[model samples]
Target: MNIFNSPQRKRLFQSMKMGWYNFAPIEEGTGIPLTDQETPYALYYCHQVLPQTIQEIQQASELVGSVLTQVWQIIRTLDEDTLLYYGFPEATIKLVKYDFLAPFCMRLDWCWNQEKGIKKVVETNPQTPSFWFECTDGNNKVARHFGLQEPDLNVQKTLKITLNQHVNRAALNLGKPVTDCRVAFTALNNAEDLGTMRWLRNYLESKSTILPLEYLGIKDGKYLFDQRTKKPIDILFMWYPVEWLIHDTDEKGERLWPALEQLIFENKIVIVNFGSAFALQPKSIFALITDLGYDFFSNKDAGTVWEYFPKTSLSATAIGNSYFAKPILGREGEGGFAVNSGKISVRSSNNDPWYTQQNYVYQELLEFPKLEIDGKSMTQVWGAWLYNNGHDKFISGGVGIRLSEGEITDNLSYWCPIGC
Candidate 1:
């Protein structure tokens, strides 16, 4: 079923203003109210639970570190080319495919007071895990009780620094005389992954000059080279659709991709394209999964699980993302659907790649997990992670709660941060 098209969704949208924080609809401007009942409620709930959540996730982080250590050891012993197939160069790429830590961050968060003392993960917006819009809606509620600043994504500093290091590296590579290159930039068009892209850009541009490409027209298919000084346009940190570069083959059988490829390849413009590379997605991931277990259904094999998920309606090609529409790469929940040879198919991105022969069991739909706030259905949690180029660590950052009456987990969710 199309979760967005459901009558349930109507109820969900109606509650958007009040759902995430239990904040009153009137809390938008005029400064936060003093008697807001939502403030005490949100704090009480977070205080009661966040402490324990933090401890558990810290342990989970260590577990992931250990697992990566072992996986790296074993995988490194493989054939040279085999190692590359697993995205050794692009850590996030390999990570987005089979890892769950980054994903868990967006979905979970808590505070820890053990050896760290009041440490907390602010967010985990791993994918399109966006909250800026919701951040605006809930600002008054947060400011009233929580005392947070407006237009905040509630991101953590560790994550902010980690991402900035990458941007700074690109800037340095652009041979900056300090003022020659801008640190980061964002787009106005809010695509699916646009939220995550913006977070990193803002984080990287922290204390740096960041101008939108549209603001300067510096990105209109032009080089950064100074026509007068003969200096190429310095590093341009951008997070745009990869589609822009390859919209179509050009007049001479070339594509815009080649231009971007040249810019990036030649290091003419230092860029961090976050959209297309949100995570490591290899075309071979599905086939690699099939070799490990469950018969990854093609259009020919989709009837097997199409009923479990329905929103996925892409006509999968052999070499594109459709290949990941199987049950191995990752979890697509019960909504994403795709088309096969002659029929429609349902698949998930959360394919485990390898499972024992009898370790898995296919079951019917079970009851949905209920998470209520103030006697109303409202809330979703998105975990965030960072694949730092500097320390090369996947530091789990924060958790964002998206509120909706129906929590099937989709675009219409509301985002709220955890604390003071």
Candidate 2:
């Protein structure tokens, strides 16, 4: 049966367009339409995983997250020279040194080889990780359409509770009542980002405001203000990356980030994930972990690190022939290249020169297990969300799956819903 032509599929697409899932059906700026005949962002069918596999993935995700959390802790104590060695900009050094609360949410991208029983986390996004609506509500909607149970039914519920906990913690730390706190969620005025902001804002139990990044203003080099309302922002929940924020400038090309950083340093305003989250944003941390080995991690954690994390290094020659060279702070596969036998095999189609200018880390390549979906062979990358429960522990919120025909999974990759 042609699921795309089915009545149920039509209704599903219509509902998605009507904001039932808060998913952006089109890629911004490119005008590329998704969930359509050409793109098919969400597949018509569902992939079912065994319960044991789900549990294993979740367990591995949490363990890896704990290890990375320790890595962040160590990174916070490093000096400016060492941080600069790890590709951190000089503009961000002060902000990264601040001892802020744990990240509210993070996502670990993993590649699994089922036949060999191997699961490895490729990279971690501690600052901003999207696909909130697709993995939770959208996945359930697709599962129901196919008469299959959604994987992790309580994912949304757990995330909402976790978000509230983080908000309350932030408010308490600022010595402000929850009702008196003014939380502003800001993102670029793009479809995906704005939609993600709204989806997360809906989960919050307190009153919050949503605005674009451009609407933010610096007042007297002390505080950040919402230009639209001309009111001071208390707690900022932004989807903007700290790396990019440091490079942001006003219309006259004057850098506006230093003032913003000053606001954070002075405790005038607090970002949700905290500015120090940028310490873990660089891919060089992977190489650092591989280098330190037992010196940095405990005997047990060192074993886990060696087993799960691929061998990575700053020099390409350090990691033998078949490896991937990726920009330290690149997102969505930008400026990533796969080198097989000392030659570039596949490069990201969405490569941006800005990222290429940054430092690159060479990581051992892991082959992704492929599946035949709708007559197309697709490789899969599993994303696991890690939430800090405010008790010095990281918990698995849920999982999101993406599929791509290419070696590198980028923004153009299809979001494949999972069922159990």
Candidate 3:
């Protein structure tokens, strides 16, 4: 039975096409397109999990968030040389040191082997985590279509409150009311990135604007401005990755990143997912935490690290076989590979030199629960979101599931909604 060609699958696709799921079109710049016969992006299916599994995932996400929070605290106190060793670009070191608070939102990628009851977090995306629309509204629509109960029903509400609260706090910190703040949301010109930003911008209760990354510029090396409106932006909520943002240049190839960094450092502009969040984006942070050992962490945090995090090292050879090698600043599983029995088994096709040329971290590989979809086996990776509720408190926002044909969940992974 080919599920993709089934009647239910067709109906599900139609429902998604007519609803808020904007990433369905093959030519919409949402993601990598597939052959005409296959669904290019989201799967017209919902994967149901036990209520206990949902609770466990939420609890584990909060614990991992705490450990990362502690690590970020230590990272902020480190000197330049130490930060450079951990893959922080020297150009943005000063900006990363001037901390604001924990990132407003982050997503931890996890591999959950239900049969073995093992959940291991692989990496953290603190800078620009996507799938916001897919996880909340899209998940609800998919669950309703299948006549199943949506897990985390209040996720949309929670996200609205969290985002608005963060905006209000940023406004207050800037010595202005929320109504007076000009919050600009920018992203590359693409469906997925723009859609995610637009979705998030709608939840913001402050005065807000949306524009493409190209329209954002710096003036007089003091503040970032929207080129279109010719007005200085106060708060920037961008989908651009910090690692890449450091290298941004103007039309004449003059580097503008330094000025942008300076603006944040001088308190001329506020960046959500603050500049310091870059300290948490590197894959090497995992290796750094593991190397720090039990003595560096509180007893409870040490236990959390050992229980939830995969053993990571700066050297692939140190992990021997059965390890995953990932570039320190890799995004969307780019420049990553897996070794099995001392032989390279799975590797990402995206050999983007920007990521491939960077340092790599080797991590112990964990088993991923598999499912048969449309007559092919797919590996599942669960994404748990961590949100900061404006009071230095961390909470699990929600969970989303991505399925891929290979071990690596890349840009083309299917967005399979989760049901309780």
Candidate 4:
């Protein structure tokens, strides 16, 4: 049965304003396009998962969060080879020394098949995870149009609480008054990233500002500043990947690592979703934890990891012939591929260039359960945002769905709101 309504699509297009993108009408019987003119995402569908599945996902997420905390504790103890394998450059090893604390905000993406009873996590983004506005604001709009109601999880409200608490703690640690703290939320200049930063800045407590990555720089030797205003940034809410920052070079071909090192070591500025995010960004954490055995995780946490994390190996060829190849640090289905009959079948459209230089890990290839929409077979990837409030509290902010026609979810995948 088709759940899409034309009137609803018109309302979403007019009200949501997904930033200049048009949601083209979904053609009846044909699969939803990667994009459409009438909505920022494929509008005709809002996927639903069993309430039991949502409960289980939250449980698994907490377990994974605990294990990740353990991994952070032992990160420095890992041999140089293991550390380097996860893409930590030689110069950045010092940053890993402060790993007792984990990032406050995170998202875990999973491929769950109900009929086959398969639920495997693809990756975890400890620091910068998008889809907040889409999931909380846009998804709710869509749900109401479909006469659906989700229990009052209130994702955006939860995010505000998480951000407010983290910012307050950061202010305290920096010896700065929360009232005087000037925080900057920064991301790349791209539309999607900037949009996310904008959305976050709206809810951020304290005096907050938003800027593009290009406008951020180190000034006066040790202070992280906004190049646009020449003002020092007291706290930074960075959506940009930290690994890239560690490798950043100036116009003169000099690595900027020294400037960042000083800023961090001197505590000139506090960064939210701390540098520990780098340690969890790579897919190898799952592999390492699995190889290190259940000793690294509590018995229950260990079971969750084994059950939800697919067998991941550093080498793509090691996981038999029909595994999925994924960059250790890839995002948004980029640098990912599926192998069948010794041939690469599916490749991510948004594969990052940096991933080409990094190692790839292979995991067992599991198919996603399909849902028929408008006579088109569609699949979805379930993403749940896990926010650690920096106070030993793990909150499942909410869940969102990425709908796609292809085997791999990519940048253009539509946001399908989940409802009970």
Clashing pairs in 4: 22-37, 22-38, 23-36, 23-37, 23-38, 23-39, 24-36, 24-37, 24-38, 335-351
Candidate 1 C-alpha lDDT tens digits along 228-334: 33434454444443323334454456544545555554555655534223332222222333333324334423432232221221123423432213222222232
Off by over 4 Å in 2: 1-10, 13-38
lDDT of 1: 0.37
| Alpha-carbon RMSD, candidate 3 | 3.1
Q: Which stretches of candidate 1 lie above 4 Å from their native place? A: 1-48, 58-129, 132-155, 175-180, 190-233, 241-245, 248-255, 273-368, 387-389, 416-420
For candidate 1, give the lDDT of residue 235.
48
TM-score of every model versus the real structure = 0.48, 0.92, 0.92, 0.87
Candidate 2's residue-wise lDDT over 1-420, tens digit each?
Answer: 553346666578567642322234566667554644343455666788876777788889888878888887888888999989888888888777784677787888999888877688999887774776776677777777778887888888878988999889888878888789889998877666776788788899999999988898988886788998898888889878888887788988999887777787777888888575677788998998988776668887887797789999999999999899999988989999999998999999986789888889999988888877778888899888888877757888778788888888987787787787
The window of 10 residues in a row where model 3 has the poorest summed lDDT is 17-26
Candidate-wise lDDT, in order:
0.37, 0.80, 0.80, 0.73
For residues 256-343, could you state the per-residue lDDT of candidate 3 as single tens digits? 7878777777778888886757878899999999889878898989999989888999987777778988998899999999888889
lDDT of 4 by residue, 66-183 (tens): 7677777678677777688765666667777663345787888888787889888878887664776665666666666667766235677888888888888888888978898888
Q: In model 3, how large is the Cα lDDT of residue 214?
A: 87
